[model samples]
Target: MQNDWEWFNNNPEIKKLMQHTATQGYYFILYYMYYVSSASSVYAGLAFGAPIMDMILPLNETREKIPSFPTNYGIDGEKYFILLGIHGFIVNAMAMAWLWTTDAFIIMMVYHCSSLFNIVGVLLQQLNMKNCNYDEQYEKKIITEAIIVHKYAIEFAEFIEKSVTKVYGFIFMVNMIMMSITGFYAVLNFEKRKSEAIRMALFTVSQGIHLFLNTIPSQCIINSSESVFHAVYNCKWDELSIKSKNLLNIMLTRSSRPYTLTAGKFYPVNFENFGNIIKTSLSYLTVLNSMQ
Candidate 1:
């Protein structure tokens, strides 16, 4: 995997692609951090008797006191509140750090794997029949290099799938439950607690975004992998020698199968499954709402 990355970076074209990917990733992480920070601030404000927004007033009115300590504990003072607020802020920051690192790492790997497939596709598509006919050695070398890179890309994707299976599966389940509960609370409190309702709504949306982050990359992998087949097919393979044609056959066979990632080896992580998650969460929300 390390050598594969080194090879990817060594190519100027791949380096450019990686640079663009890195730029996009930078902005994505920035926006997500800002969003999570705002949410954390709002939550901290509500719990620590600090008002970050005027809309929080309605929510604060419902609370008898700041949740710094249990009433029976009798720890009631501005100093205690401040201390607890500081502690809570530190804890939230740590949690956000963990979330950002884990999710960002997974997203980065997915993007790279997708880019690898795309790179292979582009290389295959650039193959010229005239050049291949004139220079058999050149043809063989180019095809061999593409095959190796394609194989490495596939192996890298498999490694990622194995590593992230449990993590994505757990996240999938948690996000579904969070989306359902938050959606239910958002709707249930819409009239009486507008602020709380909005918070819950945001939580639901965040979960949706989280699920999208996982599924979209998996979809990209599928799309790029399939494109490899098209790339190989579109090339003028008929003019190549028998050995070269045989090599192309190998690529065609392998690229015919779209690469995929799964959650818990059960649900395929793709756009279709993403929609199903939303629908399933909504169904659960409806059931909860009915019970209420």
Candidate 2:
């Protein structure tokens, strides 16, 4: 067991990725883009993300840059502090990348599920409408191929999402609980030391904001997955199958929110309750639209 552990610990590829993501574990959290996250696996194996990016189009385009701690300083204490700071960022980057992979997979699975059910329903309905003697092999073949693609996509997406969600949830819970203890202590100490309370609040609030934003995509995935079944019941029989497939794909792939999380760069969140930051702006837009 010791030798096995030593082998893994010494492995270059294994050491390249983060073992876990913790708030106190690392010092800074990078705004990890989804595609960048999945590409980490590729990087860990092949040292590049180009080939993987060809297959996935992650909605997040915000490239968050982190300033690393300077390792060149001469003093031992300064070097130690710099090393610690840089380690935190390295851990944060790995965690953020995993979080992103989960988000992208969740979105893709939902789209495929939605398309699958709608196509299935349409095909079944068509089967019922056709005469027993009429030839339906070509139509059935096309529909079967489409359903296979969707089913596999949905399965693959959901599997990846669930695995990542569970891992992230555990990491998040640990961070919150640890911070909460610190926060409680800080609140008590607030009477004597205001700065400590402020510092604790900053960290706690940042975690809260990150967790809440993370949950949004998960909920959206659930909503998208259910939509697949909804498409089945609302089929139009007279439409050509290929044309219908294209329309259904578009409808299924589209998320309810036109402005993705990345759009927040334009709207800017300077408030509590992360969702409300977007909600307030959306409400204003609604009113503007009503006036127009």
> lDDT score, residue 63, model 1?
44
**Residue lDDT tens for model 2, 163-219:** 554555564445545555545644665776564555555545555555565555444
Cα lDDT computed for each candidate against the true fold: 0.76, 0.44
Collision count of model 1: 0
lDDT of 1: 0.76
lDDT for each residue of candidate 1 in 1-292, tens digit (9 for 90 to 100): 3665587777787778766766666776676668667766665555554433334656635343344222333565544755666677777777877887887777778777877887887676556644534666777887898898799889988998898888889999999999999899899989987766776787688779878866766887798788889888987876677888899999999999998888998878999889989999999999999999
lDDT of 2: 0.44
Error of 2 at 1 (Å): 37
**Root-mean-square deviation of each candidate, in angstroms?**
3.8, 18.5
Residue pairs whose backbone atoms clash in candidate 2: 114-228
TM-score (C-alpha, index-matched) for candidate 1: 0.83
